[model samples]
Target chain A: MAAWGQRLAGVRGVLLDISGVLFDGAEGSGVPIAGSVEAVARLKRSRLKVRFCTNESQKSLGDLVELLQQLGFDISEGEVTAPAPATCLILKERGLRPYLLISDGIRSEFDQIDTSNPNCVVIADAGESFSYQNMNKAFQVLMELENPVLISLGKGRYYKETSGLMLDVGAYVKALEYACGIEAEVVGKPSPEYFKSALQEMGLEAHQAIMIGDDIVGDVGGAQRCGMRALQVRTGKFRKISPEFTASPPLFC
Target chain B: MAAWGQRLAGVRGVLLDISGVLFDGAEGSGVPIAGSVEAVARLKRSRLKVRFCTNESQKSLGDLVELLQQLGFDISEGEVTAPAPATCLILKERGLRPYLLISDGIRSEFDQIDTSNPNCVVIADAGESFSYQNMNKAFQVLMELENPVLISLGKGRYYKETSGLMLDVGAYVKALEYACGIEAEVVGKPSPEYFKSALQEMGLEAHQAIMIGDDIVGDVGGAQRCGMRALQVRTGKFRKISPEFTASPPLFC
Candidate 1:
């Protein structure tokens, strides 16, 4: 396919992925990828509007900004977007009171939201708090509710962690779907609205924006499907996407 | 399709399903289906051999017997067979120490076996104990191990419980399978070996045996595939199996 640097010659906006492209999961957000910090600094100095988009549903937006800043990336809270805030908005608009199944570290993200006698189940990567009791409670809620709703922050099958590529909330989301015979509402990457929202905030048309990330499906393919150009960095767990499945390889950066 | 009683004319042995056929989940094992008790009594009086085979891996064999006896069915611990004991035997034979993911009530079933430094993950219906922490631990164990094995007691999608047809361990088992990219060895009903083992124990061939149960897939289809005749009872959640999918309708009793 086409190359990234040449296509970005006239791009007005950039949507960046955090975990793999900017920093490796092995170093816990401390280690930046080679030239990534400088790349961000250069982009900030340029006229291009930049937005940092991540599928990490475990942490809040503030935490992400802090993490990125710690790795010497020029970012702000307003410029960083994750699945948690969008998921919470959907919960409110749908008039859903959610039984939050998420990590304790990020529960504060839902601090302002109502959680009493929840009719819907909102699941995220809850780290140590994901227990059988919580899943059963969610299952029972679905069975009991006439119209039960299951909202998953991100449907990522797995993610790179310090140990290795670990199982993510997508597996649990699928389990609940199989058990309850209900479909979950994914509120993160690959959910077209997530990309549309970020593009809308940047005031850039889909044609002017490019998504840069290491993940093929979530970042590269998702953005391409959203009518934006995509750049797949060779770093991190990047696999060569088959041409039959995708429009083209994300312009390799 | 031929009727059940007429087709059983010369059947040497009969495999029976427990829940929904003999007992109701709502009644807490105290209530029996209409004439089901006397039916079992009549079967006991006849020359036909009988064995109760179930995919209910949550309870031990003794508990099943006690529940059956409480419902006025003529059943002994030996007459009732479940996946737990057979799965334990397989685990031992394979020399795989398992990280058992099951309910606390049934953990006693695997008490005799060693659970140290487990290389395999054995999952059953953990009920309230099926938490994110336990599933994640199992996932982490599978990731860390050189060759991890996943053994599911039964791959039933759901089972009748007091609340309703609650989620079964199969859902969680499938979740793990999806996340880890591994197939689980299902050790319970619908598995050919499970049916073969029961028939072997009765000293009868598969062709000489008939299976009677409410579930179309687990009981009827499973038995019929193993060369045994199947009887699908109209009681409980019985649905008409499409002619194309099944050999013929089990003689509706």
Candidate 2:
């Protein structure tokens, strides 16, 4: 831990991804399947930013924070961001009653659906319940309407499990538009709003924080494009971004 | 338009992006913007699947198809799909009622909000009506309750408009989860279910079809990983993925 901490000497804070960087995206089991817990604990003890963001829309920050605490790290919900809650914020801010366009796992977010006007917010996620019909409706909303906005553009890759496979919202957004005639305006990931939001929350300028993640777009490239130094990890599905990266690449793998 | 179309010839099908690809994210502009209609027409005459997909949550397939036809493209509504419609199919199939979500322009799709249970499905699309009050209720349903599902893992980039910068559903998804404890289950891009669904819809075997898009994980890499030939466009971000395909230091780029 000391040696690893020293590697990030000048780095003010570290933006870590939960699944691949900290935990191994597993539930009903343990925190990690490898040495990730100890590694994360070491990072936290070193007093880094330890901010975790993920394209994963499965667990809430609170849920993840509790799970992480049990695993070994002391963290709070403030250090995380998932897709579900993000969409809700936009809908609430707009004051529109939206019909949920998502799976059974995420239906609890919107308790009320207003019908004064047909204008509503559309939230897309990666879940088991995503089907053609849902996509059809999403397409309808994106294409037919004159002013539709997309929340994020972080592309999700398929995370294979033993039972079957599921989609992340990235694909759903693309597919919906293909089926519909509208195009959604994305707000997350490579978008500056998300980066600024993170910086604003941490009380640091973009130059003050170091972004880290398993993905090329969200972690490495996204940060670099937004004026932050990035440290790519070998954890989670990190290999997909840089498949050629073996034991290490130019920088810390 | 003619020159670009000529360059796009060998590509067989053009999997155009909905946001900046066609009308430049114009909502309710009334008619197609000049060459957009002509470009699409030439592509359609060339027997291409001028397939369109967007991250916008504003319109419907029927409307888009009608609009495209009005703009002079040989298109049909059956070929479209949006997040709202997709969510509808998933929820209705399993006999589940979902909490509705919407963005600025996609409120029309959720004229019917199904909430028969405490499990809320958070659907997010880009529209003028999405607001903060909506986020509050969604947060309550998700955080207050245990394991409440929040759907709508949105995707797409942000569009700069005259009024201001607008967000898509994907970004909204992230905000919702940031406020609440529950996470959204994503169901787009690189999700095998969606890939399979597309293949099934075409009545073509996975091996026989080729998927094309600009994103790596969602288009090229996603499809390739799922056992399909993939071609990624040079445009958009992630240029590092296929940087200067003219040479090769790595096998998989």
Top DockQ model: 1
Model 2 ranges with Cα > 4 A deviation? A1-9, A26-33, A111-121, A160-166, A240-253, B1-253
Lowest-scoring 10 consecutive residues by lDDT in candidate 2 chain B? B244-253
Report the first chain's TM-score for all candidates.
0.88, 0.77
Query: All models, DockQ values?
Result: 0.50, 0.03
- Give the DockQ of candidate 1: 0.50
lDDT per residue for candidate 1 within B51-135, as digits (tens), equals: 9888876667777688878778898888877899998899889898999888876888998888999999999987767776677
- Clash tally, candidates in order: 8, 153
CAPRI quality of model 2 = incorrect
Clashing pairs in 1: A102-A126, A103-A126, A130-B132, A130-B133, A131-B131, A131-B132, A132-B130, A132-B131
Task: Report lDDT per candidate.
Answer: 0.79, 0.53
lDDT of 1 by residue, A51-95 (tens): 989888777778767887887888898887789989878878888
